[model samples]
Target: MSAPDVFAPARLGPVTLRNRTVKAATFEGRTPEGLVTDGLIDYHLAVARGGIGLTTVAYLSVAPEGRTHREVIVVGEHSLGGLTRLTDAIHETGAAVAAQVGHAGPVANGRSNGVKAIAASSMPSPLSMQMVKAATEADLTRVTKAYVAAARTLVRAGFDVLELHMAHSYLISSFLAPGLNRRKDGWAGSLENRARLGRQVARAVRDEVGDEVAVTAKVSLSDGFKGGVTTADGLAFAQLLEQDGTVDALQMSGGSSLMNPMYLFRGGAPVKEFAASMPLPVRLGMRTPVGRSFMKTYPFEEAYFRDKALQFRAGLSLPLMLLGGINRRDTMEQAMADGFDFVAMGRAVLREPDLVNRLQSERVESGVCIHCNRCMPTIYSGTRCPIIDLELAAHRDPLPQI
Candidate 1:
């Protein structure tokens, strides 16, 4: 068969998307006081109105310390009304909405959270400048329950889907990382032990939500570093997740936010913009010999992860969503032709939320996002395209500043 049209509807587990387009979860620093803000809702609503099939609300932390910033959506009681409003607004725009849930673990902003960071093993944390504690069996149990609770909260909030953030060196990915997880017991050693935490959390989420909601997971296809979870292990883990019945769909992603941070986005973070946006301590840390070496950059390329993701498509039977560096009509067509179920856009959609509607035309080439990765640092200020903001300002004034 020929490549399916990009704008076609897609069914994801219990939910049905209006189109194959998914606005991938990009952290919008819109939450404040641990509650959803109108800005957060408006952000997703704009994407939904822009004609996305499903717009994901990003980084709803399972617990407080899981957040990379002090201000983020914490899965809790008072959030019910705001999230309900968010879902309603998106639904009104004729789009489905999903919530991306995760725990940041060692990558968390413990200083801002006023707690020591926890990880899969006790390790020297350059960021916190202290040894991060390894989670105990009790801690593991607690975190697993947190996932269950987050799923319930999402269901109550009227979210049609819950995308678990298991990739990017978070709580789950930390354990999966062999370099980070060196435990000798149940939580480490072999791949099976290392993958236990993710499996447990996924099972708990399924038990909690049952068929009432669709659950998807974003998993690292590779950590892009030595002694880390390799591409081979990532495929094994993906197979295990399917065997455990933990996901309705699997989204492929790579890189460690702590290790090969630049590997996630090949173009790399704009260091100058990142430093300018950081607090004094983080700013200074980035200049440190260690930090400077850690924040590496890579060249920009379209469909950056396609090569590895194709390897995944070859092995797994579960539906997969292709992410990373998809910015053009032809790229989406390639994904369809490759037998991928969905295509997710982060910077592409951020640059042009209406890019989906515009993609129907063969004349549309790609999004206006240059992929400079300048927006990486804006996590502290609300993640957005600086270019788009400048464009909006120019449109409002209709004049140049002298």
Candidate 2:
């Protein structure tokens, strides 16, 4: 099956996308002082103009304390001007814009604003393995308020969509992951309890934003970690969200922070290395980067995971946004044919901002993303996007005439 309407416009709640191609969130470390800069504006505008249906701003923290890094954009009253400017720029190209709102949880080093990080439990991060302070009831209240406030701000700033970042072992994800969230409290014991905060945040945001803005969540179907949130848990959560009508769409993803970096962003860890490192119990279905080359070479009858996600959504009637490793037109078309309403592209959009336009015109050549994961490392470096050659060139030789 091929894409149903690859080049056609489709409605997503209130907004319409020019094409099915969405430029997924990729951090461009251009923000300074938690504010958007000219470079950031130029970067997104380039992609928007390139003909993608939508482009999401990466890692916009709902609260100062929730920030992933110092360079991440802060969605607060003070950030309205810059965010509005960004939305207007993207709108100029007829592309919709979504803001990814999240708190980094244990991943938050408080390096951005010097605030202490909070989490569902006091478990240490796998990367740093440093114990994070557990979130008190008051802290949870503040976190919920922050998400509502940020959603309101995004609406005011003219964003067309609000995507709750509930995946990749962030605060919401940590709450969902049983392995990390060992709290005996009401917000931690059962699956229903673990989903409470996310539900509250979504409800608050919806109330504030009203029915005008599209609300969605990027959710991990499984943590891919020992004793973590499983696919069954994810499905139950999805059902709850559907029953409450809290979210308009669900972006299915997998893996956890310490366990599966590749699941957060496609083509990160080499497939073989990731699979080999996994515990034997979960190694049966594992496929790594080394295996990807071979998988592409061999003629396989089975559909990929992206295709299988459609099966997962069988009972639910909500629109689904399929992501992860969707690079080529044929694969995207296959997703659409399989009943997926939308498709998202991350690294490919980063390497070639105009990929959508090239695909639409049947002129797309090889994508620029080398799958090196160099871009991911840049988030911690205070700037994102290592592939911006023009920026690198300018740094190498400043304007001599000036």
Among all candidates shown, the one with the greatest TM-score: 1
lDDT of 2 by residue, 1-402 (tens): 454787799888777778777777766767867888888889888889888898998889987767765667778878899999999989988999999998988767553356767789986433232356899999889988989888888899999999998877789888988887889889988889999988888888888887889999988777666666788888888888888888888888776654455545544444454445333422432333322321111121212356447655785788888877666777777778778888887777777778888877778634556665556555444334566755677779565795
Compared with the true structure, all predictions reach lDDT values of: 0.85, 0.74
lDDT tens per residue, model 1, 1-402: 787777888789988788888999888988868787888888897788878898998888888878876787788887878899889988999999999998988888677777777889887655655567898898888889998988998899999999998888888989999888988888898889899999999999988998887899999988887867788889999999999987999989988877777888878568787778777766666666656766687898998899999999999999999999999888998999999999999988888888888886554777778988878888767888888777788889556768
Root-mean-square deviation of candidate 1: 1.9
Clash count, one per candidate:
0, 7
Question: Worst lDDT window (10 residues) for model 1?
Answer: 123-132
Model 1 lDDT on a 0 to 1 scale: 0.85
Q: Which stretches of candidate 1 lie over 4 Å from their true place?
A: 391-402
RMSD of 2: 7.0
Error of 2 at 255 (Å): 2.3
Residue 221's lDDT in candidate 2: 70
